[model samples]
Target: MIDDAENKEALTSFLQKLVNDSYEAELRRYSSLLATSSRLLTCDSIILVALSSIASLIVDGRVSISREAFIACVCVAALIGASILFSIICQWRIGYKDLASPGEQVKFVEKSWEKLSSDWNIAKSYSKTLDIMYKSVSSRNNKISVLLRISVALLGAALAILLILSLCMINRACAGA
Candidate 1:
């Protein structure tokens, strides 16, 4: 009976640690995704600025941008804007939802530790907590991952369009000369 009790205790400890570590890892991954999204937005902004500058030069007659090139630029600009918007929405959707305040979490953990000495009730409670945390984080991660990928693809398409537009503008300038 004593050996069985010891084994159960060890198992509970291991399980708790495993779940907590996994939760932390998920949080880290989420943070990294946010960083990536931020970088994407920054790049999008730079592209917009360049497009605006070119449009201004065309308006001022300093550059002869073809109608096709202008249309392509507009399309690419729209895509970039859409990508940024979708990315922000995705980040907002996966934003952190606090299950418990820090103080409450600490108190609850302390109580669970106290219960550990008396019975397996604390282990059971921890199991439930871990389940909830794991599922929530995993769901958010999956959703954000899909959205991020789409956003990236949109950005890539925009860049390609911008490249084509630049080529068209160059050809127009050469022909005009």
Candidate 2:
């Protein structure tokens, strides 16, 4: 019947648009954030590594700072490394199981269409799907954001420690000389 054809077309269009607007949009947003967060943490690690290498080389070859100051610098570098590692782990944490449930959604849509061919039930299912996917992505993003903040804070703390130790090294060397 023409009515059946029209209803099917309408349902298909609605579902497509709903997926695009809700599921795909959320996915894209989360993916972009994940990538940016990962890059930031990676850059932080690289900087920390470089700073550690430089500091070690300088302290070993040039400066004769106190043992306590040297130890503090090493501890700060270790903590920064740990924080960066945690951020990377958090960024990769996601509900992959939830993401793989499009089959369930498909079944639900089929049942809704078979029962009444009404748009209301199909729309409800689409909305529910969108909500579930959004929640999953949002939860993952929140976790990653927290880790990123912690990583940045640790990085800042490490820099502060580096500055203080460098100053101490300078003062000690000058006083001794």
lDDT, candidate 2, residue 95?
Answer: 65
Candidate 2 C-alpha lDDT tens digits along 86-140: 7677677566426446797577666666753656555555566567767877777
Best by TM-score: 1
Per-residue lDDT tens digits for candidate 1, residues 12-112, read 78777887888888888888888888888888889889888888998899977557777887899899888888788766845444477789988887876
* Highest lDDT against the true fold, candidate: 1
Model 1 residue 69 CA deviation (Å) reads 0.6
Clash totals for all candidate models:
0, 0
Model 1 residue runs over 4 Å out of place are 1-3, 93-97, 100-119, 168-177
Q: What TM value does model 1 have?
A: 0.79
Over 4 Å off, model 2: 1-25, 55-62, 96-106, 114-116, 170-177
